[model samples]
Target: MSLLDLDHDQRKELAERVRQDYEELKSKDLQLNLTRGKPSSEQLDISQRLLELPGTEDFKDADGTDVRNYGNLKGIRDIREIWSELLGVRYDELIAGDASSLNMMFDLVMYAHTFGTQDSERPWNQEEKVRWICPVPGYDRHFTITEKLGYEMLSVPWLDEGPDMDAVREAVKDPQVKGMWLVPTFANPSGHTVSQDVARQLAEMETAAPDFRIVWDNAYAVHTLTEEFPEVIDIVTLAREAGNPNRFWHMTSTSKITFAGSGVAFLNTSTENIDWYASYAGARGIGPNKINQLAHARFFGDADGVRQVMRKHASLLAPKFNRVLEILEAELGEYDVARWTTPSGGYFISLDVIDGTAARVVELAKGAGIALTEAGSSFPLHKDPNDRNIRLAPTLPPVAELEEAVRGVATCVLLAAVEKLGA
Candidate 1:
């Protein structure tokens, strides 16, 4: 039957059927959660060797520096080399550091607001207000970091190529616009990759704020679900070619690659920016744990090792991703009630329901004994302007559970769409 032709009675009957099915499923009380982007236990098991790599006798690096010691402020060389390849930049451009690259990103914003970037006329903190361009359907944590620092967020629409370049150009022309937060590779929530052309255009922009740096967070650089990989713009190279040498700050972590809380992270940027950052960061801590760095070096060794590990992750995660997609396709593909992304790689699939229906869909899913990432969690300040986007995280749950959870979500979507259309 054509969905468009369904009368009020038919729609009401379908909604009632959905509710009945949901009640039956809820009676199972099957506690299932698909709300987080964490790797499954099986995926984590692949890196168990990392925990056993460091024994009393094995506590030294390639240069014979005691791993137990604490003097390598810029991180051990071998770890830098591993992340250098993982991030697709030169070893010199990367600065391997402690486990949280997010922390480094936070510090960069603080630095800009206080000390300012290489070409700033004055400190940003002294200004009346500072603004940051945030691509909607972006990483919440990235948005939170800037918001916590009191920077005004300007939401820019995220398109297939990248954040709207036209919007970005116009926004950055305002002097108060200090920077932009970008997840260029396999962006969080949406799982979208910024195209090389977009990257180049971003690099070439003539912002009114001289200190405006693109906070490029390449968290999922190696996380791919398809054989054909997305091309990363090598923003460092792009900035140089654009003659805006200090225009980008790149970050990545081995958190997903090795272990979540106990992995190495790094930052890459122009030498001048690095020098300015180090002047403060160097004084803040003795150094990152060099021992862990050496262990990761020994574990992955090179780009090939990193790729091998990623393939293992792909094998474990691909099934769960496929299950969600399959269920969504089977149940909802016939209807124009909702749409979702088929990401090549990344931790999430962003779903967009009929306008103004996302919140109701989420509520229905919860009532049916399934939990999802809250509606509007993808946008800055937890507001998707159209109220349509929902982030689906398929990595945390096992495939069987994912299938059931997504099916429940599909029912909720249809019911919500019908109700909205009726209203």
Candidate 2:
């Protein structure tokens, strides 16, 4: 029965029972963690071939450029060519970088602060008050970058079709608002993809700042956890068609597709934006890790090769995600106190538990030796106004451990709810 349907006596009885279950759970002293969206060790093993790939004899790229020597600052031409096809951007528009798109993303943010974009009036640091729009229930690290850089963060609603563009349009009216973070496909925790119409509206919308940017982080372009593959709207094309050619910047990496630390990352944008980033990045380093890029290129020789590997990833991930949903349904479905997203792709499932109970849920889980992503982490400055959202990552744990961890979370949810009702 729903918690709201319970009588005072019923609530007290349930509370006592839930408290007993929780005490027994703590006695188990089980150590299970669902904090970060890390890939399982078994999943990592699938890409082990990368270790021995692009062997001693494979130092030269298709252009016969000796990759062993450092010269091609734009990354290996062959690798760029493959990414261009996989990412659906012009060959010259995208440049391969070292692993970690997160690293590349921070670099771009810093570049804007230091030198500004190709069309900025001045460096962002020169502005009296610089700010960026962040959609709620979004990536925390994105907020961390803007926050650490001293930019005021404005939170907007991220609906099923993407960030509420109406709210986004309204937010950009301020001249101080310089940019917004867009996770166009399989967004970090919510798993909502940006619709084509929303993409067009963002492209065509007028901004008070002439150099406003849309930092499109398409980290899950190929990481679908289901059989159906939905195509992402061509944001670059839409932006250029809307006469805002340089308004968007796209970043992606094979970090999830291959070895996280050794995979390749790429940045896609207009030639002007590329030139702007090149000037800043070139001065920072001679070039990216070409050997690692070469291995990735040689391993996934073409676009189809990339898709085939992603299918393998789907096989491993889909079950873990399904298991998470299954546990939530079995334990909390009838309560009417919780709701969760059944993501078709991506590494996380967003769960919204009873209001004012998420922190308690997390606290109880931690006390029971089951770690969850800190409550309110999905919001800016780590504050969830309602204290209702919880992000569950199920990939890192084995099936048995994941089951136990989720059950522990469900128990806490019930106990917290009962306590909230003064049971």
Per-candidate local distance difference test: 0.85, 0.89
- Distance (Å) between predicted and true CA of 418, model 2? 1.0
Per-residue lDDT of 78 in model 2: 79
Taking all chains together, the TM-score of candidate 2 against the true structure is 0.98
lDDT of each residue in 143-218, candidate 1, tens digit only = 8988788889999999998999999999998999988999998898888889888988999989998888888999
Tally clashes: model 2.
0
Lowest-sum lDDT 10-residue window in model 2: 227-236
Best-fitting candidate, scored by TM-score: 2
Off by over 4 Å in 2: none
Give me the overall lDDT of model 2. Answer: 0.89
Highest-lDDT candidate: 2
Error of 1 at 105 (Å): 1.0
